[model samples]
Target: MSGSHLHSHDHAHGHVPVHSHGPASPHPAQAAPWSILRMTVVSRLAAAVAVSAAMWAVVWLSMR
Candidate 1:
C-alpha cells in the first residue's frame, strides 16, 4: 500500500473550526454610521442633477 492511504478521509476532512469572541453584533443598519448613508443619498442626488443638466443642455443647443 502507498503512504497516502494512511491519511484520514472521514470526518476529519469535513471539520469546521468554531470561533467565538464574546457576543455577536447588533442589527447591521443600526451598526452603520450616518455619514455613509448621507454620502449615498448625496451621490444619488448629484447624479440625478447631472443627468437633468445634460438633458437641458442638449435641448437648449437643439433650439439654435
Candidate 2:
C-alpha cells in the first residue's frame, strides 16, 4: 500500500478482448447478389423452354 503510492493498472486494464469484432477480418463467402440474380433467371428460363421445344419439334415434323 506504499511504493511511491503505486498506480499503473496495466494501462487501466480491459482494452482488447473480442472473439469477434472490428479489426481482424478474413471470412467471406456467403454468396448474396439476389442469389446470383436468381440463378440467372432460372438459366434463362431453361434456355427459353429448350428453344421452344426444338421449334415445336420442327413444326410437328413438317406436318407429316
Candidate 3:
C-alpha cells in the first residue's frame, strides 16, 4: 500500500505523550475571593439583573 511505510515508531504522528503528576491547579480567578469566578450561578444572574436595571434607570432619567 501507499501508506505502508507510515507504521514506524509510536510518535510518528509528531505528538509526544503527556503525563500528569497530580491534580491540576485552580484557575487564578477562582483563587480570588472577590472575583466573579467565585460567584454562584444565582448570584451572577442577580448581578446581571441589577446592572441592567441600573443602566435602564440612567437612560430613562437622561431621556426625561
Best by TM-score: 3
| lDDT of every model, 2 decimals | 0.72, 0.75, 0.79
Q: Which 10-residue span in candidate 1 carries the lowest summed lDDT?
A: 27-36
Residue 17 miss distance in model 2 (angstroms): 57
lDDT of 2: 0.75
TM-score attained by model 3: 0.49
Tens digit of per-residue lDDT, candidate 3, span 1-64: 8766866667578786565443485434334458787799999999999999999999999999
**Which scores higher on lDDT, 2 or 3?**
3
Q: Could you tell me how far off, in angstroms, the CA of residue 15 lies in candidate 2 after the best superposition? A: 67
lDDT of 2 by residue, 5-49 (tens): 666566756676654535667655676756535667778789789
Query: Total backbone clashes of model 2?
Result: 0
Q: Give, for candidate 2, the lowest lDDT window spanning 10 residues.
A: 19-28
Whole-model alpha-carbon lDDT for candidate 1: 0.72
How far off is residue 27 in model 1, in Å? Answer: 29
lDDT of 1 at 32: 50
Error of 3 at 31 (Å): 7.1
Q: What are the C-alpha RMSDs, in order, of all predicted structures? A: 9.3, 18.8, 8.8
